[model samples]
Target: MGFTGMEAQKDEDLVTDLTGIHHVGSYARIDNLINFENNSASQLLLVGQRRITIDDVHDSDNGPLRVSISAIETPLFDKKNQMIKAYSNEIVAALREIVKMNPLFKEHMQYYSQRIDIHNPYILADFAASVTTGDGEELQSVLEELDCESRLKKALELLTKEMELSRVQQSIKEQVEEKQRILEFIAVSKLLGKVQGRIICLVGPPGVGKTSIGKSIARSLNREFYRFSVGGLSDVAEIKGHRRTYIGAMPGKVIQCLKTTQSSNPLILIDEIDKLGRGYQGDPASALLELLDPSQNTSFVDHYLDVPVDLSRVLFVCTANVTDTIPGPLLDRMELIRLSGYDGPEKVAIANQYLVPKALEKSGLKEGSEHVPPTLSLTEGSIEDLVKRYCREAGVRNLEQHIEKIFRKVALEVVENLANTSHEDQHNFTISPDKLHKYVGQPRFTSYVYLERMYDKLQPGVVMGLAWTAMGGSSLYIETTTVQTKGGKGSLVTTGQMGSVMEESTKIAHTFARHKLEQVLEPDNAFFEADLHLHVPEGATPKDGPSAGCTMVTALLSLALDK
Candidate 1:
């Protein structure tokens, strides 16, 4: 028979299962009744007793029968050891996965696993129960659990959740650190005031590499590039986005540029600032002051976003044909870099190095195989003649176009020759100085086209003068004529769409002529008796500046004295 007992000083402290020791209710079965075997003289115990005294179990005959327990407890230490080992191993495995998920816990993994191994289920349960959320609620619901297995399962569940949370926290930390570093970089850049505060304005004529320079700067800095034209942008909403209340509301060009490049520090090219227009809507030039200003762009607020965006790190590059039309306030914020047009030698060099190869490739005339000989070539003299005779503007855009045109014609000729002649008899094509006109049609300019003709048909009232424009310098012919009037008093008149500056120059020339030539001219001469009409050729072109004063005086004096 199995027997179990525990000693307690008070009956109130006793708690045990009495199902095996109790007799079956309402039945007297030999196995169900506890057979004392007459060992105890007193048998006063009854079934289902709620309370009992120690004296009730005392034997009167044998004086507390010698109850020597053969074996008090049969310890299944192996099973208990197995259970403890299994629980500790599972806990270690979970903790190891935790370390793998987040390496920040790796350093303490061994120490934590050892502590868990020493205390086993008890310590493991405590660890899980201690894992409370920010609001002080337990992470796992294992409270009041007396079974070790149940507690271990709850602890594992809690560990898995905590590990996931640790990974999430780690990711968030890294992102925050990266954002912090970027902010610090921006702050340092702003403080240094090198490229951050600077806004560059590329001032030059058309096709002078202003936009190309902006692209090169972006490439060199390894920053994203974006370009937009403000040439005729009149609405302020184009710079700063439209409000959401509008039908087709959107962010301004600055915001759009940032979005298009997907970078906060992209190189933005605001093209044709000088051509920015002002209409009834609003002034875009005035709006650009905030976008291009370093001191205020840090907190640039868009009407659509209605939130300040930090644009201190963005590099702004603006282009303009000239600065004269740009608003003063907007112009004051930019640093001007002048890009002059290419000269003759410069054009020739550019054509040889860049334009020729590009044109050849585009026309499918360049040899594809490196071992193959070049099929098309241009002599330096021919290119020099092309530059002097045609494409005489300051920029190489027209030069490049002319080269491409030549390559196209050469390509056609080469194809024709190849179709007719045998491969062995084929020869390289070259355009010498003499053959330039055959392909390019005819020379647009000549060295003595104007001056030679002027000298050949020299007249008393006509003279040659030089004038400078954005396209480069050119010669102009000033002509003067006298129209006899009924009265001797005379008036001076000028034509040729001259600007105020040129008109003033004409007046100055007239005054100088009257003072110096009053004695030289006779009283009855047209200088005193007729209206002097001064005219410059190319009447459609609007000419300005006082540089032509001397030429005007020379023409007027020649007409008055018929010199």
Candidate 2:
């Protein structure tokens, strides 16, 4: 009768406990609540019916749970405490079962049991302090085995070392990739198109990547890049070097470059070869010819070195704005690659590919709050407009600067806009052609008038005469007029800054006209007495050449016959 009554009382207590408790839906919710409060000292009302005081909760010695209060409203505190203890014990028993079944937990438990100093009273005290009273024996055993402070310190130290090593490795990887990119850029095609002994001349306007290309090649080949400017170099000794007998003997430019690069097979860029000064000192171009020639360069003897150093393996590249100024012999040996001015399309391509991304980075907008849309790509049309109207230089150096300007302006505007907007409302931005004008100043050129003029005046007498001058090939017009005269003085009056060659051409044209007129017209009536004036427009432009002979003759004939 006593056992039956005790079992009924236990059943009634369990039923009351279950009925009053507000069940948590999931273990995840339970964990979240625990972390939310840090399991710190706080007060929680059990189902809003009973108030429970929670102390500083930590890892338990016996089990996961610590205190469980009664669900009743200030009803039966003594009975509640006993019920809580019983429930806590039940939780501890469940944990032990879990540990026994799980291989990982069992192994950890075994390791802890063997390593723990159960005999030390101080160790036992620390273990007891760390664990809660109602926790299971399995938790207590695990807690006793752990040296929390020491383990934490060791883990932190190892993580710090690993982080540092990772940073170093990343830095090294970046450096290697950068080096490889540089090498690839330089190792494109060898200048002369032949690997053997040959001189390659880089002919282009200023700032057209000539010098940069030379350097890139040297870096790519893992060789040295040497630059020597022969622009005003008048002395042959600058190239061949002064003899040892001379008081101030020094090595030539070639030897000096080799010494600087510390390699014989380095790329040597001889700049401004066309502008080599010719004076009383000696012809530097002529000396350069000896160094550049494949047949003669093998035993290139420098007077300072006093040794015939083999320059056959060395790559020689020459840069010049004009090839005509170079010595004939040297020019003959070199294979010239003409790097003409960048056209509108090429400029746009280069700007979009290399300039814009770099400019964006320079503007400090990489990770700013206002995200610049990557989809905001530079269109071919926009680039064409910019190149044609705004940037008209042969090289894109100025264009690059203008692009940077645009980026800077846009970045400022973006920053300002972002500052005005709320953080939640901010979005990615784009810069379109309509907005481009606000950033960059007005266009440099209104229109290309030269091309328009060329196409407009395409007639019989107004022929497009291409003349080669010191500047370059220029188009000029040859005009002619004939006046009937009674006097017998058959003479040609040449105007528009005519030179000796042009004057001679006029005489030739006059004679040809007279003979042709005599053959075509009646010989009795002398048409040769007429004074003829051959004039070229753009009188400010001094013109002199043998090439204008055919044009002059054609013009005079057209005027005489009125054709």
Candidate 3:
């Protein structure tokens, strides 16, 4: 035990010696002899001159160890001197904010700070270093620096860093308070798991009013509405947030939503969760795992905010074209609600109730003080014609746009003849079924849905085929016939905007037909001697896929057997 204690004491003594000595050959004055003439416990002013270096250390017989030193001179060029002056001025400016934070330093610094020489930039730097609250080692290192410019630069760096760290600390404090307030609100309401079932996911095709429905829901609940689009969002930072190390980094969508809505509990519509793209930065889907997952999200932490944000109070409603496109784990956490595209009745109702009135008000097409004077009404027959000729889509977006167009045209006429007693023309500006063609040009399309079909009667080489798609089911015709014959080297031809998979299926079907034909054909029959062409009609639709495999095979067999 005694030996260990002796060794520890020796190590401590060696460290003290090493800490005082640096490459600059300087000494740290433990007690100032020159400044002893005036001893005021309130403050001690140590004026800096030049950097002094120790030459030798000697032990006195009765008193204490003494050091002999020499002054080291360093001459600065005009550029470096100016740089030092600039940096020192910045340090002085930064100290104002720093001193306000530290009272002990402020009280003593207030007196000498005002009288300090700003002209001697090196002296100003020393003034700040001496009065500032910092690590003793760092202060001594600055005191040891001989180069005036380097010393000032290092002091400025330290001051700037200290101020920045203080700001971040303050920011974190405010965020913590904000988080606490939100948590308290959540605690009182305690709506964590209770509202997850109310999490409505509106999944349907684009322009189907999924986003509009989310806004309506918010309005009904008397809550603030905010929409966050995660479509094509590849960066995980977009969901989580970039770290503070990144310049101009900020909180992710969830935290940003809270800031934007200005309420702890706002209805947030997360749009296009399915269309999130993956990239090298990170998988946004994985980041959203913690965001949407209710159990894990009670304490959601964004990298930029670096705090556990309580997203539980903020209701999240997601919208997507298809649920299958959403990540499995993410989809599993929410209540999936499938919203089909509007039918003809639903589309017409939406246009009549919501769209026409809104567009008329916006276009200033009114007779009285109120902008919506019910002056313009789209006749039901005209609406039906518009639906059939202009738009027959599953969504009402196109229908709404067309309605907007009619109101816009009428608005222009109202403005043009405002001075000309326009009551006659404005009141009779109703859009009738016949007048729709006058305003929007001739009927863009007939009330006929195009379908792929073969000739009325079954031909020897043609077969009626059926296919399914995202748009719906459709029937098509596959036609095959003999095209060329030479040297018995039969070649097959395929056409009709077929993709790679479709082309390969046609080849497979053709091979299967030949195999079957060879078994039934007499050895002398020239059934496989001619080149044949296989074609699918309605080339405009760009048909492709293995869905047509069976139809292609049946057509080949019909051609081979001449049935």
Better candidate by TM-score, 2 or 3: 3
Q: Order the candidates by lDDT, highest first — what do you get?
A: 1, 3, 2
Q: Which runs of model 3 end up more than 4 angstroms from their true locations?
A: 1-201, 216-224, 262-265, 323-336, 366-375, 422-428, 442-444, 447-479, 484-491, 508-530, 537-542, 553-563
Estimated TM-score per prediction? Answer: 0.60, 0.51, 0.55
Q: Give the candidate number with the greatest TM-score.
A: 1
State the lDDT of candidate 1 residue by residue for 1-563, as single tens digits. Answer: 22223233223333233322221111112323344666664344322211121212323453423222221121233336676567667776767666676776676555455645336465565454444231122331343344667666666666766665565444334435332433343356647754554577878778767787677556544579999999888899988899999999999988988888889889899999999999998999888988888889989999999999999888888898888899999898887777677777888888888889889789876668332236457999998988888877777888888999988887777666667656625666767988888889888877623233446686999998888876656788999998765574578889999999999999999999887788776666556767889998889999998789999989988887788
Which pairs clash in the backbone of model 2? 61-140, 62-135, 62-136, 63-135, 63-136, 186-216
Distance from true position, residue 300, model 2, in Å?
3.9
| TM-score for candidate 3 | 0.55
Q: Tens digits of per-residue lDDT for model 2 on 170-214? A: 332333533343333233434543345446777777656778666
- Alpha carbon lDDT of each predicted model: 0.70, 0.60, 0.70
Candidate 3: clashing residue pairs, number: 0
Candidates' RMSD to native? 27.2, 26.6, 24.9
